[model samples]
Target: MIEFSEVSIAYQGTPVLREVSLHIGEGELALAVGRTGSGKSTLLGAVNGLVPHFTGGRLVGRVTVAGRDTRTHRPRELAATVGVVGQDPVAGFVTDSVEEELAYGMEQLGVTAAAMRKRVEETMDLLGIAELRDRPLRALSGGQQQRVAIGAVLAAGPRVLVLDEPTSALDPGAAEEVLAAVTRLVHDLGITVLIAEHRLERVLQYADRVLTVHDGRVSAAEPAQAMRSAPIAPPVVALGRLAGWDPLPLSVRDARRRAPELRAELPGAPVPAPIEPGAETLTCRDVVVRYGGTVAVREVSLSVAAGETVALMGRNGSGKSSLLWALQGSGPRHSGAVTIRGTDPAGRKPVPRRMLAALVPQSPADLLYLQTVGEELATDRAGEILDELAPGIDPDSHPRDLSEGQRLALALAVQLAAEPAVLLLDEPTRGLDYPGKHRLTALVRAFPGAVLIATHDVEFAAETCDRAVVLADGEVVADGPTADVVTSSPLFAPQVAKILGGGWLTVGQVAGALR
Candidate 1:
């Protein structure tokens, strides 16, 4: 009941989506998958008329949703027919309390006060956020705020739901909750859902059909089966097909149907044998960090032995990033101490010396500021890009002009210039596509140093890390083998485990067993 006909949109005089025509049937769940900057967000905006109307784009063709012409309707009017939950929910927040946040949307539609209250309560219950009704929007965690945003839109009872990377900012556990809730709304309540996500494996099973968008055009639209066989299938999908499973598994349960053989052949899985222990390298002892009124991290201690790779896992706002910052001497630490090679991080003379630590932030470009990529590398150390450990990225071009993968490579090359003994990566795979992630992971594995990574990509952690640390509410909750924590623990278990079965933590492991 939602359609786009010969649609073309340009932002700030630049074309983002061109001649894209598609339709979403009533109650059908469809997934729009593409690489970064592929116009997936632009496609979702057209359904709600946020395109040429609100976003200041030049619209070429007609768009309609739920029998309403998008060109003729404003975002407020379209909200009654379509619900939207964006990637950063906090950016859309206007109210303080959860209850008011839900009511605000309906209130804008001029819904009767009594009906608004009833709808708000119903939505909170449906999304399992009833207990958070009184919590202030600022006080809620990233996941809680996102759920509240969904509930706010659902309260309006739209016929169609359009979400743009709704789970991109959420942790694994919170992401699962949001996805499950979306599926329930579609299967049991008959709501049409269209979602654009980079994590294809997580939402592949829920899709009635999969559409691939590339370079601002609809590249492929087919049944899930056809999409699975396409040359550009997600890593897990390709691995499932290679394993000879009949009709290849989409979700974990389907993969588990063959778990008997899968488990029996565990010996054949090509997991790297445990390496010999190395000497102590980077260590954090009783670290405590507070942010004004709240203690974000407290007395959290961890260590990364020489040649060891450790992963930090947790829900968003669980103090994972805070702990990383404290270790890197970027965030404020209230009490306790951190020792890297017997050198405290809080000291003023900790730069590129006895305890050198390089932190690769969530956005690699955040640390990049040179005119040319070669100059960016030169800024840190001459000929640094030629290091055998660095990825092959063009050196002559501007850093901002490179692709996400290339930019990530350049960031690493610069960080390695100092030849730091310790590396700290925070969300290294945030915006990467399937291939980009694999390439970056390879680079991480090849680096010669102790590494500590904090990420939501649990599969990556399982593939790269030997030890895992799970943090929640400013405290270390669990720490042990990466496989044990990711596959068995409640906090670190990823969607891959929930979808593909327990033992297959990484795509390589899953593919190896299948072969």
Candidate 2:
């Protein structure tokens, strides 16, 4: 369905994808896994002629998708043969209503009204998004928006679908729904699917073949079953290898088949009960927040106790970010009150004490403006903070010049400069590499402050935090120990849930049996 022959692309005279060659067969599901800026998105763009045509890149070699040569085909011409869903769903939305959003693509294709209506209904049912047909596009959650976007494309009946991080912003439940819909589209409808994703654990099982890309080159392309023991395996895949299972299973049910044998090989230990409550550090009492005329957060009550780490989870626009900012006293919260260690941290008082509640914003760039990473840390504190958080990062290197992961570490080091007792981090691992994410997780776990992380990375929350809370529709729907809460809540359960019989979240715990 798609073929790349010695293909290379450069943006603004700078090379991105170099001599990439691969073939995606018809009605096959292929996953492109790679770290950020490794040219994964560039490869996807090449499918629909977006790389050279829209991104102003120099394209070399031959590229074809759905029997059309990409070198000659423009994005508009390829739209009928190929449907591309980008990383951000909101970026692709062109209408206010869900029905209109789905029909927009068909209208552009000049399909008759009867055919468009029939296709819209069929696609909506296939994606199980019929209930969202009447909702305003702006008011819908990110996951809902993503589903609608996929439905819109499916309605067009394209031969091939290219999705870039479709579930990156979705919750575990929503991601599953999207994946299930894609599976149906591939198996039932016989559509060719190519997906680029960072969350490999969720999609690896569904993928017919796995293509691992590193530094703009294909490192490995093999059957998913044969690639189970690769060093860079997901937690459960590694666990399956360690558990001595032959023909390692990709999904949880497959792993469960070996559960009895796994149990026999282990020395059973008592699973600890959920921890008791501690002294309140940052407490929110019936908080209400509004934007313009619409309420963003209702009477939501939650607390981050002293010396504890809590994870806030929900769909996008589900008030996770709003609640995090509200704790800092800068958000739209008005009715409810929040107190930090017996006093409102939001109140104007001593600078030193107020700085105790440090907030790490969603974007690291917001906190990074220093000419040199070293100078940034040095300018903030005399020497002690720099010595602790930034042990080896050059104190004089420019922050903007560093890699995404490096910049994240540098930003985090600066956030820790205040030595805040209550640290608030929002999606700290969004663009980080595996190693960078591991380092950040360790940093968060080692910190002594009361930490509240607002994130969608369930695995990270399970590994770093002791407690987890689910915030949906601006209210705390569930709260308890991280493992227990995640395992119990359907909304929060991730691929890791299938492996951790008692709901374990970390890769380390999965490795314990191997040791």
| lDDT of each candidate versus the true structure | 0.76, 0.75
How much is the lDDT of residue 496 in candidate 2? 49
Find the 10 residues in a row with the least total lDDT in model 1: 382-391
Model 1 steric clash pairs: 252-499, 252-500
Candidate 2, residues 155-227, lDDT tens digits: the string is 8889999998888777777788889989999999889999988776678889888777666666446644545
Error (Å) of candidate 1 at residue 339 is 2.9
Candidate 2 global lDDT = 0.75
lDDT (10s digit) by residue, model 1, range 401-492: 55544566678777767777788888776656666666666666666778899888776677778888988888998898887788786546
Model 1 ranges off by over 4 Å: 10-18, 54-58, 74-77, 219-223, 230-236, 261-271, 274-279, 292-294, 347-355, 360-421, 490-504, 510-515
> RMSD to the native, candidate 2?
4.4
Clashing pairs in 2: 374-395
